[model samples]
Target: MNVCDYRKLSISMSYYLQLFRNNAGVGRTGTYIVLDAMLKQIQAKGVVNVFGFLLHIRNQRNFLVQTEEQYIFIHDALVEAIMSGETNLRMEQIQELKKSNSYLEQQYKNIIQFQAKDIHISAAMKQVNSIKNRGAIFPVNSYRVHLTPKPGEEGSDYINGTWLHGFRRLKDFIVTQHPMHHTVKDFWQMIWDHNVQTIVMLSSLDEINFAQFWPADDTTSIDSDSYRMRFLSKCNKSDYVTRDFIIQSTQHDYELSVKMLHYPSWPNLANANTIYDFIVDVHERASDYRNGPIVIVDR
Candidate 1:
């Protein structure tokens, strides 16, 4: 492979390694510790087959390698290694092998109906606004937090939010779309009502579709009737934008420290590997606040 291809493969390898642990229900730290020890053992002994490696790994530490895709990932790694100028396989042979593997992958996906789901997603279509095509939150996994509006309001108090459960039954986050101009007040109301400590805004304010809910200047603050949120500070990373916020209740004396981790270069899915560090940082920051759920604005 060329230099660019080699670099891409290296990035993919790292991403797949992380996914391997996730598939086996291992935490980030545990994955690193176990993989480090396993690699050392492999070096001491000799290279082994996929099953043999997995067996040794399971023996060394308790893990669950769930799903065929995880196993296939390991197989792909072996295939990649075999084709990395390490083996004497001809170009034609390598191409044929890759074609066979692709066929098998497609067959596996087709058997499982991986692309076609016979479930109804249009049941809540009535609640979806004109601007948002896929805005309906499934009632089963939706957040029940509704704004207690005063007498004269016409619309329902339901905000477009959903409770996102974290690993090991930890209910850690509430994710919602970017608030429209009409729903800005409702957004703040939801934050105050839910006692949300961290607010992760994942959209760029400069985007035409996105509304500038908060003031652009860090010196300025935005205030709702019940709450006051100010831009405390910001740190710009290579892959994402991080901002600290101080939200205080105008009615009550309580306050909250919010961290907004915004990744603007999304939808451009090439950033999947590039944003790994940013994602880790977000996780680490959110883990600090154990009392309240973090609000993730996905736009």
Candidate 2:
């Protein structure tokens, strides 16, 4: 078998640059992790099979593995290692690989290796799942958090959200995108339907591209077809602002106070310690409310 020339991996700058630019950030991180695997394959079988490797991440976050220009490339140094008949690939000792050709290599490297990803179970989670024939075993749709459909409206059940397992229950958390102007009403409907007690907002009300889903101040109130949200109080802190609201279901005879902790500039923490502290704070406040799914909104 002929040894692969690694430089053959490099394509024309115009083609490669545009691909990398389009698939920045999360795309970058996924590709490098897969590249690390590709290196090992080259050391053994002498081939790299993917142009881009990403987006198969769990939890229904996105479409799995969007690819472009399905092409296989070769690596030089690793292909030669088979001549010595050594099968184990020690990636760290590779001198040629030390040079970062792909800018995506460093993104989430430590977190990918060291982060705790296993699901945690609480007493409540077990209790909820123990209910006989809960229908969770056979989901009607793939959506994690299903919204109540508006009367006589098609596709009202659809929303850009997914349920996440938390310590409290199998579906204790709802992670969703920032609502656009059109979907803002549907957003409130889900909150009202599910009896969500706490919402964690990652973006500010004034931020670009994010619809102002809530009222700006304590004196303001926003009304929809099915619900009325009135500001109750505001607590300002260094890293976050807590806003309390009285949510009344206009259609149903029920009223509840929901608390929202908004992080205007999320993940702008000083260090890992600050990030950990922020998470702990959010969890603590969310637990202080009535038992319900905690809503986490994306920026």
Candidate 3:
């Protein structure tokens, strides 16, 4: 197929449909490939870690599809090529990576690249240090997570979290900073309200940056707003610790069980095989909450 067949554009798209799947040019074709890789990774494991996907595609060329704008060019061209009834290439499989080189060329104004200046102007965002990770990291207002305020806790719709688009099977994932002492109540509220079943705590429970959000001992219970958590059991693993909890709402006659997997240590890429096995464990444990958005906490 000729590289010039990308003139036609279509709308019905993949996980990228909400992000980018239109416009003209070859664009960053690697995005489609990376997204495809992401989908397969998630489909097989029931979830995905960005770092894992990055490492999987490291040796492959052109996997850096950063922005949504990059999705359309290559995706459209691939669609057009397949729609044109090209019999020579495996269009269904997206086997034509070389033909997309030309469409990948693009440039943008410096103003669009950096939003640091824009974030400095917002009052709430500037004062986010109180709620977030001490303002060590700033979030885009457009992408920030807004928790629902409890009954009388007006202006409680703030958390240092953001929703990210997930691949094929999964719709969205919430990423937030580690729950601070003051914000632990808010964190539990978010989990209870949002119906989060599986929480992947990537950060270790170190004293400095990360803190333990759940009950420290098996006999004690922790209360946050209307929710109360009693430690059920702890399962020790090689790279992580799986803790189960029985959470009950003090207000209503409702109780929800939550499973948290905390990584005490991480295996490097050198242990790719081990990581894949770990993915399977996470997949099985998270099956109960696969329908809802998985909450991920980082630094």
**For this target, which candidate reaches the highest TM-score against the unseen true structure?**
3
What are the lDDT scores of the predictions, listed in order?
A: 0.59, 0.59, 0.61
In model 1, which range of ten residues has the least summed lDDT? Answer: 114-123
How far in Å is the alpha carbon of 159 misplaced in model 3? Answer: 0.7
Compose the digit string of candidate 2's lDDT tens values, residues 1-299: 12243232423333334445655355444444555566666667866554333323423444222344212112222232333333233676566655655523543342244321112111113443222122223221233466787699655655656676676556788887777666777777788888898898887665556757777777777787778988888888766778888889787888977888887777666657656666887789776865778999875
Number of clashing residue pairs, candidate 3: 3
- Which has the higher lDDT value, candidate number 2 or candidate number 3? 3
From the highest lDDT down, the ranking of the candidates is: 3, 1, 2
Q: Which residue pairs in candidate 2 have backbone atoms (N, alpha carbon, C) closer than 3 angstroms, thus clashing?
A: none
Model 1, 1-299: lDDT tens per residue? 13332332222443455445445455333333434343444446755455665666668666534555455544444434333423244777866767687665754554454221112222223343323323544322123345666567533355666665666443577778788776676777777777776777777665556768766767787787778878878788877777777888888889977777777777564666657887788778767776777788866
Ten-residue region with minimum lDDT total, candidate 2: 115-124
Q: Which regions in candidate 3 have their CA more than 4 angstroms from the true location?
A: 1-131, 134-136, 151-154, 168-171, 267-270
> Which residue ranges in model 1 land beyond 4 Å of their true spot?
1-144, 269-274
- Model 3 accuracy (lDDT, Cα): 0.61
TM-score of each: 0.52, 0.51, 0.59
The predicted structure with the larger TM-score, 1 or 2, is 1
Model 3: per-residue Cα lDDT over 1-299, one tens digit each: 22322232232344244344453323345554555554445446755454455455655644455454453334443433334322344556455544565432221222233344353324235454445545556555545666766577545777777667677444367888888878887777778777778888777677765778788877888786678978899988766678888889888999988888876564233566656766777678666467567788776
